[model samples]
Target: MSNDNHITIYEHEILRIDRGEKRVSVNQLKALQEFYGESGVPYYSLIHNGVKFCEYVGVLQVGDTLIEILPKVDKNLTDSEASWRKVLIDMLHAVGLFNLQAPSSSNLKLNSNSILDLYFELFVKEVKYLLRQGLVKKYRKTEGNSTSLKGSLKFGKHISQNLVHQERFYIQHTVYDTTHELHAILYKVLKLLLRINTNQSIQGSLKSLELEFPEMPDLKITEATFNRLHLNRKTQGYHNAIEIARMLLLNYHPDVSKGSNHILALMFDMNLLWEQFVYVSLRKFKKGNTTITAQNTRNFWKTSKGSKSRMKPDIVLNIDKADCVVIDTKWKNIKNYNPSPEDLRQMFAYMKYYKAKKVALIYPGTDFSNSSGFYYDHDKYGAHEIGKEECSVISLPYNTDIRQWQKQIALDIYNWVEVNDESSVDC
Candidate 1:
């Protein structure tokens, strides 16, 4: 590679010179060579921050002072990869990056934000319990002094001389106080900061691995295939990479704060999204398959007249090849909260425009019209509605029993795709 490809090295203190040799890894050496050059020595340049002393030199040694390199100033960083980066970090932590198997008694402790998030989760659980117990109720006395009405009766209770019939009660638990809201904001920010780095690493690794191992390769079942299989094992198991990097960060930078500023903070932390994407992508890849996401939109205009109003579809199937169909994931249950006309219309539009033979609007529940391992189809609009079409609003119960939602999310995506693929037909 040339000097153009060299990775610039930045000192901990901006533009500071390292007076002594520092041990560098083989990989780090390679990275530096690629950024600078084998023969070019690094030197301080006040105007450019740092530059090569000369072209085409030899390997660098310790005590060979190099000025810190400076990166270009970024102004629109709020709109940049910072958001996705946070998500990447979080994913890494979730997937065994943070000494996952170490004894709980280990001296390692989570940052303040992690502790705050833990507390917030606990707080939510407490609120749910309090709600279940019902809110405070007020009691009142009713008339009836024949026997002195020994104990007071509740309001709306008809007292017959001395005896009381029943009690009427009122309860209220919908409290959104400052304390609760603050906790929620704090929890979200902390969670985002914690997970973003891991998420990015997972995504970068997955993409790189996929490019190297195409799904539909034509090959004979021979030694080459066996070697490739072993390589796949190493590539998929990125636990070592995650652990090493995490250990380095935790050991070197113990004072860094891990918290997000706002919702955009979550965007910078792509850990959750990376996990969701990689899990879905790789599982399909492993099975020599492809997947798609569904898109939905609504319009109240005829095809010829354009639209008087518009409604965006909840989801659309974006996959290109293979049997085409559309499906959407909903965290809500369909039974308790029936789909509205808008929801049905949106789904129908997706089916009509996408030319999909079957459309599934999946909800998080185990109930449907037919069997439990369920599958069903219906044309709900009865041919009179503006955007009526064939649709299957199936309820697939989420495995809530699983303690780790991330693992369960991957499993759910794989199982759903496997069972519902067009080839299966019976899903």
Candidate 2:
């Protein structure tokens, strides 16, 4: 089906709208429904003051405009209709979408005889009601003293208490300052529209190249082209994903719930960026005499039989000459000032079991304020005495993408291997 012939359905009916050059076509109706047919109790409407307004309908249009009375609601019970329209109008005005223009003489003439005449009439009635409310303040100020009156701004500054101020009266009726609120809301909407447009443009470009120039060589980004990609600024996905990850990582807050345990598990499991870094970094260690194995070695040794003491580090890079250097990737940093005894003992046990001298804990750099590497020497049984200089703790910043980090990790491992070949492998 042609995308153009869509009908917008609202409240299970087609809301005929003014589409300017576009017809009140079924396609437009469908598009309208998909875009703005939000279902809920109406919150604002045009009413002729307190009188039950039974006529007039509201239809939302593209670009933050609405056509009232153009496609009116045909049948309506009085009380419900009045309340619905009231909410609809108020909401539109609140959101700065209502920009009603005075009807021209010809328009009024047509409106008078039209089937939706009552809708127009009801709209005017509500406008008049507002006008009455506006006038009430104007006259009340003229008669009453302004000192004690708190309703309007004039009263706020006055010595006498009788008059209310116009400014305050206006403020009371508004959801937000219309001018400033419109500027922010419109800017936000435009930004979102631009992002979606960019995505569509990129897809279209790729399709065109495939169809018209299939044999052409693939597009390669040169230094000049590299500048065009603009990878510096954070993308929408980055911000959203990071925020979600941060919340889950800090699940220590009692009020911050992650829904079901299964959902929380999945949420943490989606730490793609963190996982990428860990795996790529491990690749480097494998290139030099050491082979890195995943899920083959336990992170922690089982202290007691039947006790689930095995710890599976994301990836373990074994040094071909000696024990393995263990590393773990964590999205969140260990916030406690001191590492838990269990964790320290686990790393120690890992060093003993794997018979590796070096160990490192990798955490996302964004989560930590400080970066420092340390060495621990426990010579209680001459353990550290035997290899006092071999065991070290390294803290590396997690920045660049996985590929870049992987290369760096490989270089670091190669350097370590070169320096170690001349020294004793065991303590």
Candidate number achieving the greatest lDDT relative to the actual structure: 2
Off by over 4 Å in 2: 1-276, 284-286, 298-308, 319-323, 332-342, 366-391, 398-402, 416-427
Candidate 2 lDDT at 102 equals 28
Superposed by TM-score, candidate 2 places the C-alpha of residue 210 at a distance from the truth, in angstroms, of 22
- Residue-level lDDT of model 2, residues 1-427, one tens digit each, is 0123221221222233343332344433333333323561231222222111112233322222222322112223233433333433432322222223322111222222211222233333332332333311111122333223344444343434423443223211222222321122222322222322212323343343224321322232233432333222322212222222223222211112332111111011213334444564555345635677654455453455656556555556764336567654444444434444565555666556666656544543322222223334556654444434343323343322334445555565445534443333232
Candidate 1 on 214-294: residue-level lDDT in tens? 133222232232233321332333223222322222222111222221111011112223334334433334434445442
Name the lDDT of candidate 1.
0.34
User: Model 2 misses residue 16 by how many Å?
Assistant: 38
Shift of residue 413 alpha carbon in model 2, Å: 4.4
> Against the true structure, what is each candidate's TM-score?
0.29, 0.30
TM-score of 2: 0.30
137 Cα displacement, candidate 2 (Å) = 77
Question: After aligning candidate 1 to the native by TM-score, how far in Å is the CA of 352 from where it should be?
Answer: 2.1
